[model samples]
Target: MIKNILKSALNNFQAFLVTWVVIIIVNQLFIFGACFAPYCLLAALPHTFVIAVLLNYFLNAEESNKQLNSSKIDSNSDFKYTQADNHIEDNEFEETEIPFCPKCGSKMALRTAKNGAHAGNKFWGCSKYPKCKGLLNI
Candidate 1:
């Protein structure tokens, strides 16, 4: 039913959002704030299908990494690695996230900007706050 489909889509929103981000980035190659290229329209169909397939990928990010025998994620350790039996190893390669800080290249934490021209706006701030003052708007 339509209701069931909507509910399923809502549950997989992370993948949907990621797919949209990719589409927007690709569309940017043609123009900013607009997409008039025929390739963009053609690519939309496959992107939607890929988004649905990536539902589990986006929702269980750490699990997916384990499946690939990649770096183990430690959410409790602020996504940083520590020497332990069941923790991430330093030698393992790290995946580069698109939203990492532009200044210090650290993963930006989602935070509210207190004082700025766009006060109260949600944005990404470098995890290394006092040490690195990198920020990005949502």
Candidate 2:
């Protein structure tokens, strides 16, 4: 996806450069005709703006459609379950008490901080606050 986006941005830049080069060449040609230069540029300006606007609109629409399709598939998947089903109850399970960090074997403790994103808000922080101070966004 990142590569695709980079390719698209490069393509748009190349196209924009080619278009302005052509426009400049045409305007230069009309300059030799004395009275037609201004008129030619005036005519080309509106068309260029229109084409640019249309391209932007279509690109946005395509991106929106891709997002919508992915979300639709996620929502329609069969594996999703509600919280109350009790197939996996969180509180019923015994929390593993670790005296050391699993990754580095350093001392660890049960701490709480803001975590996870809900709706439009993003709130995330390390479970070990004021000490570990590892913050994140979810």
Candidate 3:
């Protein structure tokens, strides 16, 4: 139900596009009905961008929390866990292997934003930089 929807949308690629397309379509319909101009599409960009950014922030935070909890539980096993599991390694978990870009089927590179509000945060960027700007936040 709700959990399945959230997991599917958060973890899958096609679901992401479907979810956003529906949102945009509905928003555009409302704007068209009220304003009756194709030019309003440009005005919709900022609204949609802000919504997407905010949603990404909260979803990423929740996903990180879930992973942290799961890793802690796993660290309790008989095998020696990494020092970070027992409070020795850096506070951050080791960077996991990056997945291929869902959009373009290209390799994704780990990149840090040199200039932005998220300047130091790491995210995955598509190898096809100028052509395909697919991204996945880490």
Best-matching candidate per TM-score: 3
Task: Name the lDDT of candidate 3.
Answer: 0.70
Residue pairs in collision within model 2: none
Per-residue lDDT of candidate 2, residues 27-127 (tens digit): 54664353345766676676555454445445655765787799999988977676775477677888654454434445555444445455455434344
Q: How many backbone clashes does candidate 2 have?
A: 0
CA RMSD of each candidate after superposition: 19.9, 13.4, 17.3
Model 1: how far residue 64 lies from native, Å: 27
In Å, residue 132's CA in model 1 sits off its true spot by: 0.5
lDDT of each: 0.64, 0.55, 0.70
Give TM-scores for every candidate, taking all chains together and pairing residue i with residue i. 0.28, 0.25, 0.34
Q: Which parts of model 1 are misplaced by more than 4 Å?
A: 1-98
